[model samples]
Target: MPDRPATASLDNPRYYLQNFRSVLRWVAGHHADLLTPQEAVRLAQFEALPEGSQALLVRMVMRKGDQFRASKLSYTEIGPTTVALQPLVSQGWVDPQPTLSLAQLFALLTRAELVRSLQAPLAQAGLKRNATKQAMLQSLAEASPQPAPLAHWCPGIADTVVALRSGPLFQRLQLMFFGNLHQDWSEFVLAELGHQRYEKLSLLPQSRAFQHRSEVDSYLQMQACRDRLDAGEAPAAVWPDISRSQAPSPWLESRRARLLFSLGRMAERAGDSTLARQAYRLSTHREARLRRLRLEEQQGEAEQVFCLVSDALKAPANAAEQLGLVRIRQRLGRRLGKTLERLPRPAAIPEIELVLPRQDSVEMAVVAHLSRADAPVRYVENRLLNGLFALLCWPALYAPLPGAFFHPFHAAPADLDRDDFIARRQTLFDDCLATLGRDDYRECIYQRWEQKQGIACPFIHWPTLTRELLDLALGCIPAQDLQACFERLLADLRAHRSGLPDLIQFWPASSRYRLVEVKGPGDRLQDHQRRWLEFCLSRGIDVALCHVRWQASPTAECET
Candidate 1:
């Protein structure tokens, strides 16, 4: 709860121990109500232990597995491993005589150690000392040994295997602190090494991810099922656990929707349409409704799909979904012999044909062919526009609203992808966008670009969006155009973030520019690219699709 102690400094060899202590304190302070009685007791016990014992235990918890060879568990800061492990052994936090299967035992010991330890078994099975680890294990397969203490397996070996009993408890605390299992202690190392730096945010008590213990348990449950699913388990096999793990929190509900959507897709791939439909119906994921409608349509249920699409059209989830729903509705209307109003056709995106000498990439070749002294072409792709938007709207994006950010390490808001993300900070975003009307907008963008350089952001790409590119864009592109593009981005951050034109040609002298989407000889426009191009066309922005053909060279006659 207080500032980190001097012992926690990065220069200290025991920094990891300090990090573990910080996490324990943070979890206890913010999530006190959510902690179980047993967890609270364990935390108190862990704190009461000798510092060396605590460090050793933290080291094992941070390691790859629960089991460790006593010989392998040496640390300079913790002094002698034996002395540090004594408190752990006394407190029953570690099992000195851990039961390990043959596989686990083989993983912990070297081949030479295996040969020396099982000499009698090897001799009985006609295996020599030169035998491989697998061969030695298989030779004793018929006389299958039950899992027992390391002593039972290798009594002659002086080393002991210590299994940390509190690994799972420590893991729960970690999950509560980070809000997910994917991010681990390595984040601290990254920050300390300056490979990654985060915005320092003032975290309030309620800024935490989970409001109740049930949400934490639900997240853990969903994560376990997700792990099982990722491990190639069938959807049907893991469905029951996921089904029972639903949470009322919107964030957890979003996770549930994603998991269910994945399960639905897996079920569909497995030829279980019934299960797939059920999963889709249960999910709140945006694509789930569209997928369900398409599946129903395939089954000759046009009327049902028609009704759903018509209702969905009244209040579409986002632009992408709205586009899909319109198409579905139009198709169903025609099939049902009902007349429906049609939307106006989008203006055609102008196309250009170029035959250029091959280069590293199609985009590079196109840039080479199109670029001139006065008009310079840069492969901005999605980076330039997204980067500019990120720079201008950095304040709104990183606003310390409740539940938006809980920790200092966040690259962006936690609710960036949430539905109400824009509405919650509409005024702030409007103010940011309002600057575009004045000359100060350029300075504002440049200031943030310089200030927040290399800080992790969802949209800003520091490596590619250089100052020259920013200056060229600001000089050439009109203020209203930037505002339009930024507004479209805010419309559906998830959908409109990508699929931008690959190259931008700047005519700085005349204050003009053109966006080009490059395509190779056989390539065609994709849906998202077309969507972006169409959006540009509707906004009166100059955009062109360039089709590149490789220029042929004359071959030498019959040298062979």
Candidate 2:
């Protein structure tokens, strides 16, 4: 207690101009009156401005009752007199005491280097004044000389200014700068000492612009798959591990399901029946959950069942729950017998087909046969059958496969030759049907398109159908052969001629080339298709789908 440190007083004139310079620096880009006495004192220490100079500067900038009032002025008369002398002290030329002239002050203030040197002290002095006054004083201290702009007091201070101006803080600083010049400058000085980036201060999470959960999940899954592939593991073996290892997140369920489905397709393509089966099984489970959610939504359930299912699926030891889930599905099927009956046969063979009974089921029967088939031929046959199946299921005006019906054809306009057109249309329909009934449906379909139009038909429009067919074919063929076939198809499409009809028939028997009229109604070809098709056609390849109109009913008049 006896050795308590003595507080420095502001009465000494030796430190007066130095303190004044400090206050001016603090107020440069901020308001003055907002500074508290304690803050002013801290700012003075921060800028290393002398105590007496800070007190003098504060008194000169702020009137009584302003922020600097708390630090009572010990040399009030001397404060204004020193401020008037500031210009002279800044120039290194001393102003004689009696005739302190404004011209001499101006001369002193105009020296750019001297003014910059004076910045540190002014900034410190500004901190001691009321927050508002301190800021004004700081700005005046840093003002540019008439001939040359004021040099930045610190080397990187310009960068800080640029950053502050470019950032969000610029607007706030501008407002504060022009508003109450005293308070804002003090706050700015405090902010600088705090090393805070005013622009980056955000309160809202939405402003962060983070990636969506699904996107991130999808990327991770792909990377994991690629990593596995790089490790030389078969695609089929890698999928299950990838799916099982996924992090639990409701928003990522759909992405996870898609990844699993892709892996299943890859396994099937590689002729890894066991691996393919596993992947498909995982995908089907996810699909089933999605279907259940859709059903619940339709029934107006209180909570979205899919969200709960996703949570359950993400739980530890998820595989153990499979048996219970299957039993639940069976019970549900029994309870909703009529509803189950009305459900359309899944267009593609699912991985879980073996688990279900195969009576009158298209996917199960096809997939079961595909698993037993061999090599390139098996792959080709599966693709052919699946493609036909897809066509049958598709609700087009004229479907080539059995069990498909054409919405009644409308008669052409009276100006056109209706009879001739009808005969041609009838022949085309008959040929398509005949191809479907052949023993080698794949060759037949390909032959029909190739013989007629010298081009392959569009398959991308129906991704689900393509995926299903590809999976089945992969089960039948060796992975290398399957990949080659896919490449062939892609190459053919790439080399096909432009303006060729949309549908092409490939008949291997009678003619190697034929045109099939195919159309993806309301579907636009993507950039990939356009480029591929253009390349193929440029290479004299025959493949194209022609745009066509179909009448709604037999009684409706035909427009084309």
Best by TM-score: 1
How many steric clashes between backbone atoms does each model show?
A: 0, 99
Q: Write the per-residue lDDT of candidate 1 for residues 1-560, one digit (tens) a residue.
A: 54421124588888998877877777888788988898899899999999999999988988998899999999888999999999999999999889998878988999998888888888999987888989887877778878878899999999999999997787788777777787787777777777887777767777788888888888888888898989899999998877544566888888899999999999999998888998998998888988887788778578877888888889887777788888888888899999998788777889898777766799998887788999999998999999999999988888888887765567888888777889999999999999999988999998998899899887977889888888899899999999999999988888899999999999999999999999998899888888999999989999998988776753422110
Top candidate (lDDT): 1
**Each candidate's TM vs. the true structure?**
0.89, 0.18
**Candidates in order: C-alpha RMSD to true structure:** 4.0, 30.7
lDDT of 2: 0.35
What candidate 2 gets wrong by more than 4 Å, as runs, is 1-222, 227-233, 243-246, 284-560
Question: What lDDT is reached at residue 432 by model 2?
Answer: 43
**TM-score between candidate 1 and the true structure:** 0.89
User: Model 2: per-residue lDDT, tens digit, 87-199?
Assistant: 32343122222221222233323244334545565565554333343353445556533332222333322211000011122222223222212232233333334432121
Sliding window of 10 residues with minimal summed lDDT for model 1: 551-560
Residue 27, model 1, lDDT? 80
Report the Cα lDDT for candidate 1: 0.86
* lDDT score of residue 175 within candidate 1: 77
Error of 1 at 238 (Å): 1.1
